[model samples]
Each structure stands twice: as C-alpha cells, then as structure tokens.
Target chain A: MIKRASAFLLLAAIAIAAMPSAALAAEDGELDAIHHSANAYYLDFTPIGKLQLPRIFVVQHEDGSYGLELFRSTAAAILEGGWVAEIDHDGEEHAEGEEGHAEDGAQEAHAGEGEAQETGKYAGITLAQLEGHLVPPGGGHVVLDMSISKHLVFAWLGMIVVAFIMVRMAGKYKRGVGRDTAPKGLFQNLFETLILFIRDDVARPNLGAKTEKYLPYLLTVFFFILTCNLLGLVPFGATATSNLMVTTVLASFTFLLTQFGGTKDYWMHILWPPGIPAFVKPILMPVELLGIFTKPIALAIRLFANLTAGHLIILSLIGLIFSFANMFGPTVGYAVAPVSIAFALFIYCLELLVSFIQAYVFTMLSALFIGMAVVEHHHDHDEAHGEHHAEPTASVA
Target chain B: MTLFAASLLAPDLGLIVWIGLTFLILLVLLRKFAWGPITSALSEREDKIRESMEQAEKALAEAKQLQADNDKARREAEAQAQSILREAREEAERMRGEEVNKTRDQIQHLQEAAQTEIEREKQSALDSLRQEVADLAVSAAEKILRENLDADRQKKIVKDFLSDLPKN
Candidate 1:
C-alpha cells in the first residue's frame, strides 16, 4: 500500500507539471499574449503586473483583426506619449499666449505643474485585457470573463452533498437489521464497524456500564473527522480539518467535556492529593494545572499536524515536477510526468486510509481522556476490602 | 501571502452554521430511530439465553425424578421375589409334616392287627389240648373195667358211674 501510494504521488506530480499553463489563463481573463519570438512565447502573467510568464500559443492572428493587442500597454504609458503630441499641436497657441504677458507665463507654468501632478496620479494604472483573439473565417473576439474562485465554491458544495449521501446511507443501515445483514457498501460497513468498535473497544472498556450515554458524542466525533479528512482528498477541495482553527475548536469541545464530566474524586486529587508529602503539594498543584491545559493543546496539534503534513507532501511532490520542467525541457518533463502522476495517485489513495485512521485515533483518545476524568477510583472500596490501597496521585486538574 | 492569511483568519461562518445544523438533525434522528431498539434487542438476547438455561435445569430435574422412580420399582420387585420364595418354602414344610403323620398312623394300625392274630392262635391251641386229654382217659378206663369182672361187678360199677357222671 505504501509503495502504491508513492507511485501514485509521483505520477500525479508529473501530470500536474505537464498541464498547459495557458489553461490557467482561461480561468483569469486579465492576461494577454503580446509577442512571441523564436522559442519563447511572451505573455502577460497578470495585467496587474507586466511580468511575463512562459506559455504556448495554439492559434495566431493576422492583420490585427482581433484588436486584443490594443490593451497590451498601460493607459498611463499611452497618456504620457499623448501629452507630447498635444504639446506639438498647441505650439502656435503657446507662442500667442507668451506674447500677451510675463505674469500669464508664470500662471501657465503653475498650470503645467498641476497637470503633471494629475498625470502622476493616474500613472501605471492599466485597463484590464478582458478580450481574446478570434478564430478564423467570419470571426469575433473571445471574451474570457468568469469568476475563477467559483471552483472552490463548487468543491465545497460537492463535499456537503457527499456528506449528505453518506449520512443517508448510514441512516438506512441504522433503520433495519435487514440492511445491516449485508455489510457490502463502503459507508454502511464503515459506519457499522466504527459503531461496534467504539462501543466494544473504546467506550465500553473505558466508560464501562454508562458508555451508552456517551456513544452519541463518540460516534459524532468519529464521523465528523472522517468526513472532513475525506473531503480534503478530493481534487481542489479545501481541507477544513487541515486548518488549525477547526481542530482547535474540536479539541476545545473535548476539553469542555472532560472538565465537565470530571468526578469529585478526580478534582480532589488534582487539588489536594492524598498521602503526598506536605511540601510537595504546592509545587505539584501548578504542574497539574499546566497539564490540564496541555491536553487540549496536544489534541489540537496532533490532528492539525497530521492532516497538514499529508497535504504538504502531496503539494511538494507535484511542485518538484514543475521545478524540473523549468530546469530541463518538455522532453524530460514528459518522461518524468508519468512517474510523478503515479505517485500523486498513490498518495491520494493513502490519504483515504489516513482519513479513517486519524478519525478513529482522535475519537479513541478523546474517549480515553474523558473516561479518565469521570472514572471512579474506588479507593474507599479497596480500603474496606482489607487491602493496601495505593495513594491516589495528582493528575490533570 | 496576505490573501492566504486573510483566508485563514476569516471565520468559517459557513462551516459553523452547517455543522451546528447537521449535528442537531443527526442527534434527533439517532435518538428517535436507533438507540431504543438496539439496546432493547441486546437486552432481549441476554434474556433468551438465561431462559434457555433455566429450561435445561428443569429438564434435568425431571430426568432425575424418572431415575428415582426406576430405582424404587427395582427395589419393590426384589422384595416381591423374596416373599414368593419364603411362601414356597413354608408350603413344602407343611406337606412334609402331613405325610409323616399319616405314615406313623398306618404303622400303628398294622402292629395292632399283628398282635391280635398272635393271641387268638394261642387260646385255640389250649382248648384243643384239653379235649384230646379227656378222650385218651376215657379209652383207658374202659379197658380196665372189661378185665376186672363180669356181670355183678359190672352192675354196681354202672350205678356208681351214673352218679359220678351226674355230679360232673
């Protein structure tokens, strides 16, 4: 599985690198191809910056019929030249005005300075190139103007729809034993197995008889994390869990549960533990309190780091092919493309597995922590049984 | 970099809204549809197992009862066999006693008969002897009278003989 993931990651990297940069231009309308010479195609990367990025031209124009080249330079540059032409056209008027008065000449100099200041205000501001070259034979200009960010919006919508579908399928399984009899579907089997695992392995063992009361929270955490993790694997989807804010909020909830559910015994031990040396209590209390805060912090970082690392690795592998393509030519780029694409595909599949594992680990750990807080120590019972009860030590406050 | 920071810092209001709504709906659905039935089913299964165990215990008790009855029957049959044997022995003893008594009576009767016959024979013998002796004496006296004397003596002797015979 690991090898396959690596192979898929490599292949995906290569495929991403080999994709035509011009395709990106199709999304952004404010870019135009100004000139092409020999081996290099000079195209505006963004009209905001006249900085050129390398690209390939699929079609050419003749007689400047498309007229897209008109917006190539900034409006400021054109206006600067227009001022020179205006000065030449007004040469006769300027000589006539100079003969009228020396005071008038001083006023004209002030007016010219004011005009220069106005020109500077509008300097470097360019009109956006929102048009494209036309195709041959009874042609018209192609205008590329659409919201590029809409892709991310659609991706989020897709995630929600998929989540709904999964929830519905899980509901079907929950509805009847007949549906549960066949554990063939992915979501159904996953949900059923997770429910049983949490009930028997984590919740029952830790929470014991009262585990049923807390099963809903445990199940919710597991499915919620799983959904977010899986969503991150889809192409162009934002990783909500990869964001620190999301994980932190989740960890905070766990912290709240742990604190709220804590038994009197749990708090007592944290505050004034039995059988501890008199001098040590003061020092131990602070350390115990610090430990309490770190629990949620650790939960937050563990989830955030794991998810972010996976995404970074995928992104870096794809980036490697781009760097390689730039260093060499398309030939080496093409040759290595397959290897990187295969690796990316492999990584995507691995992410799917990681998604479930991370979710399970998070839920299990949360249950464990909550269990610790609420668990009855039974020190009194032990003492009554005529056995030597160990002194209860201070834990997280 | 600024755009990235802005995007990150921006509150995910959409997510919070969606998640809160989704969680509420899920909680309601789960409470309504899943929890009650699943728990009850598990409890029911446990009850069934316990019931079957109790049933098996009852069956075992009944089996033990039948075994005790069979033992009792065997004991009763043994006692009846002994009683029959005892009755047969008593009957044989009584028959033997009757047979002995009858044989003793028959022996006694035979002995008495033998003794009576012996006595009768003895008496008859004595009577016959007396008769024989009297006849012999008469023969001798007649011979002597003939020799002693003739007519006169014979008359006197006849008168005396008649008187002696009347007296005898």
Candidate 2:
C-alpha cells in the first residue's frame, strides 16, 4: 500500500512539475505544443533554458556584391552582427522610420539598443522574423540563410550515436567474436538480430542476388531512421525524421537508386507495356512515369506526417491542461492534469510503436520500389498478352 | 499559428543539405566499418556450421559402415569355425570305424592259427600210439609160441596177457 501510494504521488508530482512550463507558455499567449514541435533557431531545453544555435547567411550587399555573415549565436546575430529582433506590431513603414533613427543613433546607443539595430532596412526584424528569412544590408536581400537549427544538431547526434554503436559492434566481429563464435554481448546480439532481419526479411526477398549490394544502404537507412525516431522521444531531443526535408532527402535517395538501378524490363514495362493495347500504351506511359515519382513522394510524406502527427497528438494532450487552466483557473488546470497526463502517456506509448512502424514502412516501401524496378518477369505477360506471345512463338517457329 | 503551420510543412534548404551530406557520409562510414564485417562474419559462421554438420554426418556414416563390416567378418569367422569342427568330428568317426574293423580281423587270425596247431598235435599223438600197440602185439605172439602149451593153457595165457597188458 505504501509503495503504491508513493508511486502515485511521484506520478502526481511529475505531472504538477510539468505544469509550470505550461503556465509559463500560457502567460506568453502561445500554444506551447506548436512552439515545441516547430523548427527553431535554438534548442529548447525547458526548465534549463534555450541554447541558441549559430547562424550563417549569404547576403548581397548594396554594391551588388555578395558577402557571407556568420554569428556565434542568435544573440550574437542581434547584438554584434548588426541585426535586431523585429517588433510584432511594427509595419514596414514604421520599421523604415526606425531604421533612419537607428542610422542616427548607431554609435551612441549601440550597447542598449534593444529596440532595433543600426542596420538601415532590416533594423526592426527580429530573430523570429530572421529565422529562415534574413535580409541583408544596403537593399540587398539574403541569398541564403544557412543557419543551423535544433533538428540538424539532433540529426547529427542520432547519426553519431548509431555510428558509434555499429562501429563498435563491427569491431567485435572483426576481432572474431561474432564471426568464429556466437554473438557474445548484448549489443552484438541485438544488432545482429535487426541486421539479419533486414537482410533476410527486407532485402533478400526484395533484392534477391542484389541483396548484398543493397544491404548496407538498407541497414543504414533502417538504423538511422529508427535512431532518429527514437531520439524524438527522449527528453529535450528533437525528431530529425519528423522534418519534411529530411524525409524528402531520404526518399530522394531511394528515388535515385531506383531509377539508376532499374533493369531493361522495368523501363519496358513502363514505356511500351507489352500486355497493353496500342491505344492504351501512351496513356499508361504517363501514369507509369508519374508512379515513379509519386512512390517516393508518398514515402516522404508518410514518414513525416506520422512522426509529426504523433508528436502533435502527445503535445496537444499535454496542452489540454494548460488550455483548461487559461480558460478556467489553476484549480481547473490541476483537476485536468491527471487525465491529460494519463492520455498523453498513453499516446506517448503509441508514439513509440509508431516510431518503429514508420521506420519499417519507409524501408519496406523503398525495397519494394527497388524490387519492382529490378524484377525480371519474362513469363508474366505470356498468358495475359497471348497476342504478343503468339507472334513471338510464330517468329521462333 | 498559421505561420507555424506553414513552417511545419516547409522544406528548409539548410536542413536538406545537412541531411543529404550527413546521411551520405553516414551511409559510407557504416558500410565500411559496420555492415561489411557484420554480414561477412554472419555468412562465414553459417558456412562453418554447415561444414561441421556435413563432417559429422560423414563420420556417422563411416562408423556405420565399419560396424556393418565387423558384423560380416564375425559371421564369416563363426561359419568357418563350425565347418572345421564338423570336419574334425567326421574324421574321428571314420578312424574309429577302421580301428574296430582291423582289431576284429586280427582276433580271427589268432583263433585260426590256434586251431591248426591243435589239429597237428592230435595227429602226431595218434601215430605214436599206433606204433607202440604194434610192438606189444608182436611180443605177445612170440611168447605164446615159445611156451608151446595146450589149447586151453594158451587160451588162458592169452586171456591173462590181454587182461594184464592194457586194462584197456
């Protein structure tokens, strides 16, 4: 009884502890959930604080010459890099008036210049405004804003972690640990299970003799996506796979491999389609070509949407407590916390399943696409397209 | 909220480049350090297992063959031993029969020689008796002639002589 009571108290304490951040977000008048899941210029280690990431921008100067700007942090960008955070209510004309004022008082109030910086046109633009859109000096706009974000850092971390474990496992194999004998340690056995699963189940069935050729890529994709997906569930960690761009690139790799590795039969099936009538051949060509792109596009969107939606759901469930509090009182918030957290916990568990499932789905689809592209089915159309088959038979005779 | 919503689906170029570059590097590095060795080792282990299994099966078959050969040799040795014992028994029976026949013939020859010796001795004894009887008769006749007695006296003498001579 005592132990159970203590566990319940602990749960309640954790629930209550998480509410302050919710309250803080409510005070700031923003949906903390959206803010949490959105891409940001800094890492939000809530309760500890945000760590600002460095920003890099390619800017065009007024003289029509291009220049690159670098900042150690977003704060440094605002303070030292002659940039300022744009005010929410300020329009362009108001910003222009402030730019003139900033030009006048450039040297005097440079230190305490919290309102705007001395930069002429982009004086009033804030860090939020300059997030993906950093305007340049002297009427020149930003050619490219190549700032590092939280997702990128997390992505690199995931990569490093996966690489470290795999390389260490590989070292054991090289030393004849798993090679000569059974896999000894936890890491070796665990990795071997997953690796073999990918080889036998995923790659071999789809890739056939080409399994070895594509095993590395399949294994890499599986572990990398799995690690990234799991990283999102970690506290203060972001899901890199949740990013559309990340999935897009991954899917595009599959796209490139599929196209390049395509066999002659694959092209023939798409272009000429031996079984199809002459009238339908042209129509089928466009559809087949479109299918080539849609496959990868669907791959990207499915992974991105699944991760994002899962995170959004959990975040929303947690946000419910704050929404109730803002609408009613702290009492109401406290009342709703348990139910909100219970549901969030449930969804969080579901998200764990979703993470694995999404990774597997992506890799499976990729393999399937590649498998379809390289499939050699000489006899598939023999029965269905007997007209074509009869002509070939007659020619042979 | 709308801005954030838009940003959610927005594809960031920097992120794209980072993901592309880093993923490629990861793929290359993992292929070198991890996948290559791991897969080769797995296949190597599988091959070793299969080879050992095949060797075990071969050894088992060899053992069975040796057992079968030993059984055949033992049966052949037993049959040879039985045949030798039967031959020895037949030879003993034939020799015993020959010995019995020879002993019986020797006994018959000894009996025949004894019979011939007995016949010869009987004949010789008869001849000697006959000669002795003839001499006695001649002496008795002379004695009777020399005495020249009457007929009655001669008759008594002959009777008396005959009674005294042989009690025959």
Candidate 3:
C-alpha cells in the first residue's frame, strides 16, 4: 500500500509539475505563468472542471456614492454591469499593464463573452490595466476588489489549514499531552520540534532575551509561508508565496516590526555610527539607511524568486518535451517524455526542499532583522557592537 | 480577470491589503489560540524537568552525606567497643594482681605468726626445762647431803645433768 501510494504521489507530483507547460504548449503561456502558475478566478479540481469564484467589487459610482457589487461569476458581472475591455489604440503599442490581447484575440474574447452571455462562465468580465490597477473597462472606478483570486483563495485555504493544525495542536497541548508528558503523535512532535527550532535556533539566537516578544511573528511567518509554498505544490493549486504582493506583505510586517521595535542603539547606529570619523558620517549614513530598506527587500525578493523559479524551471522543462516534439516528430516527443519526467521529478523534489528552505530563510532573516533592531546594545562602543553580534553569532553577510 | 498578464512584478494593491489583513489576523489567532499555550507548555515542561533534575542531585548529595555520617558513626562505635574491651581486660588483670598480692601477704603474715608462736613455745619449754633442772639439782643436792656423800655418783649426776642440758 505504501509503495503504491508513494508511486502515485511521485507520478502525481510529476504530472502536476508538468501540466503548466503542457497547458502553455497547447496555448502559449502568459507572462504570469513564467514565475508561478497563474490561476484564473476559477478553481480547477482537474477531474472536474473550472469553478468560477464569486466576484466582489467595491466601486466608486460616477455620482460619488460607493457600492458593493457581487456576481456569481465574472461573466455575470460583465453582463449585468455593462463592462468592456480597454484596447490599445495603436497596434502592439502599449504601456506595461495587464496582458494586451491582440485585435483578433480581443474579438475572440468578445465573442466568447457573447456566447457566454446566454450561458454562465464560458467568459469572464473584461478588465483593463489602468496604471497597474485592474479597473472595469468602462465601468465605475474600482475602489477595492475583494474578489477571490487563485492566490487569495489558496492563501485563505492555507490560513485555514494552519489554523486548524495549530489550534488542534494547541488543544492537545492544553490538555497536557505536550506540556506534562512527551508528545504522542507525529504532527504534535513535528510542530513542537519546528516551533522549538524557530524559538531556540532562530529567535533566541537572533532576538536574545526579547525573543518571546517577536517569536509569534516569526512563527506565524514561518507557518504562513511554509503553508503557502506547500499548498501551491498540490494539484491545481497556485503558490501564494510565488506572488510578489504576498511576499511583500510578509516582508513589510518584519520591516514595520523592526522599525517599531528599534532600540536607541539600533537607530543610533543607523543614523550615526559611534566610532566612525566625523567627516565620514554623512557619506556612510545613506549606506547604513539603505541597508535597512534592503534587508526587507532582499527578504521579499528571496522568497518570491525562489518559489517562482521552481515552477519556471519545472514548466520550462516540460516545455522542452513539446519543443522537441515540434523539432523532430511525435516519436521524439514520445522519447523525451521519460527524460522530461525524470528531470521534472528531480526538480519537484528539489522544489519541495527549496520550499521549506525558503520558508526557513524568510523566517530566519526576519528574526535576525528584528533581532538587530530590538537587541539592547551596551554603551561601551565596541561592546555595543559585540552585544548585537553576541549569540548565534555569524557573519550576516 | 486575466489581469495578471500585463506586468508580473507589479504589486497587486488589493492582494497587498488582503494579505496584510489576513496575516495580522493570523498572527493574532495563532498567538492567542496556539502559541500562548504551546510555548508556555514547552517552557513549563522545561522548568519541570530542570526542577526534578535539581531535586535528584540534591537527594543524591544528601544520601552521600548520610552514608558518610553512618560510616563515621560505625567507625566511632567500633573504636569505643575496642577501648571498652581493652579497659575491661586491663581492669581484670589489675584485680587479679591485687588479689594475688593480698593472698601472698596473708600467707607471709601467717608464716611469720606461726614461726613466732613456735619460737615462743620452744623458749618456754626450754625455760621450763631449765627450772625443772635447777629444782631437781637442788633436791638431789639435799638428798645426797642427807644420805651420805658419794662423790662419783654425784659427779655422774652432774655430768648427766650437764649432758642433758639444751645447748645454749
């Protein structure tokens, strides 16, 4: 049973990893799929088909009143709200915005909408890119789109999963299974170990005595990022961590926490290094301040890029098989499948490892940054520097 | 909305807000529902184990001290018993010597008394013999004077009397 399950798991992993490129091969992929598999507002259960999510928009009316619009699906939203697509005036001359459909493609989308008018979700509501915001093409200004996207939905699901696991684990611990005695189950043991790792290995070493204050954020980020990353690996799921907005928010939390938690010494060091010669302070000040901003940026990008790159490589590898088919023949495509799958499987495993590593990196860096901020530094100049660099000491570089 | 295709890296403001809210909510949730109990439990368990360990060490030290005291007491008792036994033996020897000396003195005293008594008896007997000899000599002298003088017999009696006298 175990063998079969494992084989099925391996096969399923390869297949899920390969599907994005396959879908793109059938229709050349968009810019979105390069980093992470993009999901439409529709949910795909694979065996079943698309499940169009409810569309919600808080719109600013032309008359200056606000309204909340809810539609069963995007098609319903367009049909009821009288929306259209924003087409570029010139041929292929467009600013950087949402995907620019070619003229023919635009018309097809219109036709699909016309056909879907009678039906339900054959088409979606038209959207136009206006200065990086997705506004209704000719509709009221969109103040906020609380619409559930692939990532948002997955994020909720991930949150739910984290909550359920943690809450249940909390219950067990509350009953004293963990506190009074040894933890009994695997999940209990695993979470305990991971939590302790974050506490002792990450938070304590970095944040020191004030570790308890920032530990919750560290743990939350870890579980949240880890959950999002793993959830994306599931069949028909998109990685929320692969999204820039998601990673940015996670990093910004650390950034805000670090800033707010900053001690006198932390701020002083950034604003003015103690031992540096007076003349060089201004020159080094910008560099020091830039380091602060760069830390979180690096944190955000590191997580986003790592997760996105995993899918990109996997999708490209799968794309290779089709490219070979086009180059040689069906025979070559047939021959390429095994090699493509083997490499995809290898990369899939690597991606799993990377997922955890990325989560760890994100959490660790956050703690370190917060540690750098909140850590109390002694007034004895060099000793102050030494204090921050004290425990779990390593070159931050 | 097929809107993500335009620019991949552009920040989704809606998502940013949603994630911000979601993450904050999650932080509160986990902190309240999960981490509060779990972390406290872990630390509580740690403290309990640490306390038990300290208690064990203290107990062991106490036991070793008790053992040392027991050994010392046992050693002292053994030494006391040895001294008592030696004292009893010494006392017995002294008593035996005293009794032997007393008995020897008593025997010596008894022998001296017996010797004195025998010497006195001998002297009295000798003195009595001397008196009897003197009376006999006087009486014999009277009888011989009264009966007529026989110088040879009288001389023989004197010689026999002198020969019979104890050596002075």
Interface root-mean-square deviation for each candidate? 15.7, 5.3, 4.7
Q: Any runs in candidate 2 off by more than 4 Å, and if so which?
A: A1-30, A84-132, A384-397, B95-168
Recovered fraction of real interface contacts per model:
0.02, 0.71, 0.58
Off by over 4 Å in 1: A1-190, A235-238, A380-397, B1-25, B35-168
What clash pairs does model 3 have?
A97-B6, A98-B6, A99-B6
Backbone clashes in model 1: 24
TM-score for candidate 3: 0.78
Can you give the lDDT of residue B29 in candidate 3? 99
Q: What's the candidate order when arranged by decreasing lDDT?
A: 2, 3, 1
DockQ of each: 0.03, 0.33, 0.26
lDDT of 1 by residue, A51-89 (tens): 311111122234444322222222322343221111221
Off by over 4 Å in 3: A1-36, A85-139, A382-394, B1-6, B103-168
